[model samples]
Target: MDNVNQAEFWQQRYETGSIQWDMGQVSPPLKAYIDQLPASAKDQAILVPGAGNAYEVGYLHEQGFTNVTLVDFAPAPIDAFAERYPDFPAAHLICADFFNLSPEQHQFDWVLEQTFFCAINPSRRDEYVEQMAALLKPQGKLVGLLFNVDFGRDEPPFGGTKDEYQQRFEQCFDIEMMEASYNSHPARQGSELFIKLQAK
Candidate 1:
């Protein structure tokens, strides 16, 4: 966990091609969530933080969501994403630490969480919750998947339980939905929880 919170570690991972957590496609449960969203939701400002490869952002753009932002501290993935999506607004690809994002300058209708949460140091969970709440507009949502199983490791992809997640997030968000993901990718099935929490 020494450099788990640092960009260099992730950048090295991407550079060395050691990203096992990457599914190489948009997450199934998240895709289902996106697909069900009404057309009006297309205009909603969305943020995808710690967006490695940014498959979700690409999917959003392809589906005509204009106001999507992708943030990641690692340059390798962001650079690769830019190459993959040359037409995607350059301003939307933010290569910076998620915790450094200015709440006063950035606000979104919702923030999408994927592997991002698990990649952070466990001690920063509270900060993550507080920052997430701050980055959203009133009544905004924090939606996506969280690991429901603990990996008990000192590295990234660190996992946790539902009870722990509820305790950590409820201080800043109303737990509208936190349940087993029925449509997770095959590799993640039974291990992921699809969550939708509204900012309080």
Candidate 2:
């Protein structure tokens, strides 16, 4: 089994500051998406699994989103996030494996998939798709960016082509948008794909 499935492995990475994917802020594309959200969306139950630094969660809370849940395998980042946002509901910050989260107890209106999918074991890609479907309410959306280019390595942030992603995610989600990001961050300009899918 891949070590990325373990919490200890990720805890160590956070302790040593080994997360290169962390932009030290929310992803630009995601920020743009959040900026356009209607006032009615503030109460939607949202999940951000594998949320390392949880920058997106922070942004959501800052914008008055009341029902945001943040989950991370590692405790270090979660602890740091708690310190930064003391009033964020303590119960909403969960330090647990995303796959183990109970669908019966933790349903959501939508999920935010940042770098989480790429950080998991490639062998579990299908399982990820199934789990995401289970966690969402019917017609719930999963929106975020994915790497369009292969990183050619056997570690975290493992990348894949659009065809592979389309095939995998299409199993349980209705693909609304999956195309090259026109306004990605400078470093990710040509490498990212913005995807928005609804659970089907």
Candidate 3:
């Protein structure tokens, strides 16, 4: 799809408040992961793309992460998030396409994914993986959740299997972990995989 159309699609979802993917809070498994990270990691540059409402970003900020960035093309949710967290740095709230972000200009030590992947057009999966790799610093990690089952939808929340994800990501990342999350939110239980991949 063209840029204007893609932006409009997601924008309409936010405009209508039809975002079912907005978990309203950080996913439990991800919260646990954050709880265990070393304090020194607080300064690492981190990015969260397609970050609607951005509960995780808010959580990270509350936990004292100093360099967190939230990227979402949609303006409605971005505006809402800014309102909710007025103290969040305006510069860090990037309202831009994930694919358009530049590593040379916006390098990250890690990127946090929530439901962004399944929301994208499936044909762009390869480009998504490539862009993610390019956007990370060497050995940077992409850590977050992925759907393990099909949602049987024609629109957002597109889903896939583990084998497909492994094949697509393996060429550019070291798949350190991709398994059924031990502590997924009640609604997402058994259907979510927690992935931890490091740039190769």
Best prediction by TM-score:
1
Q: What does the lDDT read for residue 104 in candidate 3?
A: 80
Q: Please give the ranking of all candidate structures by TM-score, highest first, separated by commas.
A: 1, 2, 3
C-alpha RMSD of each candidate structure in angstroms: 0.6, 0.8, 1.5
Give the TM-score comparing model 2 with the true structure, all chains together: 0.98
Estimate the lDDT of model 1: 0.95
The per-model lDDT (C-alpha) reads 0.95, 0.94, 0.91
Q: Candidate 2 residues 1-200, lDDT tens each?
A: 38888999899988999888899998999999999999999999999999989999999999999999999979999999999999999999998899999999999999998999999999999999999999999999999999998989888788999999999999999999999999888989999999999999
Report the candidate with higher TM-score, 1 versus 2: 1
lDDT of 1 at 109: 100
**lDDT sort, best first:** 1, 2, 3
Q: Per-residue lDDT for 4-107 in model 1, tens only?
A: 88899999999899999999999999999999999999999999999999999999999999999999999999999999999999999999999999999999
Q: Kindly report which residue stretches of model 3 are placed more than 4 angstroms away from their true locations once superposed.
A: 1-5
TM-score of each: 0.99, 0.98, 0.96
- Evaluated at residue 199, the lDDT of candidate 1 is 100
For model 1, what is the alpha-carbon lDDT of residue 144? 98
lDDT of 3 by residue, 78-146 (tens): 899899999999999999989889878998999999999988888899999999999999999999999
